[model samples]
Target: MQTKSFAALAIVALGQFIAGASANSGYAGSCTNIQIYPPDGNTNYWKIAADCKNNAGQTNLNTKINIDSCFSNSNGALVAQLNGSFHSSCTNIILTGTVLSASCRNTGGANVNTSIDTNNVIGNADGALYCFNQGNL
Candidate 1:
């Protein structure tokens, strides 16, 4: 009887250990820190965040994103493309600053696409956002 009780307790303990390990098993993402500034003329500030997603369980990511800057007067547009690998399930994104309007969209892909709009699209000297991997709750 004692041996059986000990075996059951051991099994329960092992199950708990396994559950804890799996809780945080598949978490991987790449979040690069970025600082944004207000544009010229406009006093408002703007910032952006990215939450890259991992592709499959293969542990590989091929991402290409564009960041565009459009002047208020329809003065053409400037676009910047990004390329990188994101090896995580999901990433948390946060942005803070003053702007006319800001937003983001997933578009259509494993990677996430974001956008921000300011009245003048001004860049601030000291304004930015933070992005990183989210912890399991």
Candidate 2:
């Protein structure tokens, strides 16, 4: 009887150990940071910068920049979206958006294609950048 009891306790302890190991197996989610630069210089263009980190166990990580609108004049419009993907940690990511024309009537635009200027690192997860217009028309 004592041997049987000892065996049962050992099994329970083993089960608990396995459960704890699985709980702390891998990185659970992702982290993303974004910075926006206003329209400037001769080109009158805006830019969005992003940084992302993907913990282990994550997959199909995607990063994006979403432009709401650019309203100044007839030539004003916004780039719809800019995006990038990663499988791990990264830094100093540069994503360029469309140029804002110096026209009043050409205002408002949506997600535009993005160019990945620099991808310092790679990991697994999803991330994005959102640009919303909050200026008066």
User: How does each model score on lDDT?
Assistant: 0.28, 0.31
Best by TM-score: 1
Worst 10-residue lDDT window for candidate 2 reads: 82-91
TM-score against truth, every candidate:
0.23, 0.23
> In candidate 1, what are the lDDT values of residues 3-101, reduced to their tens digit?
999999999999985564343222222322222333236422222332324433232222211112221111111112111111111133223432222
Model 1 residue pairs with clashes: 28-87, 28-88, 29-88, 37-123, 37-124, 38-122, 38-123, 38-124, 39-122, 39-123
lDDT of 1: 0.28
Candidate 1 has a TM-score of: 0.23
Regions more than 4 Å wrong, model 1:
29-137
lDDT of 2 by residue, 36-73 (tens): 55444642344434454434433323343222231112
CA RMSD per model (angstroms): 18.7, 19.7
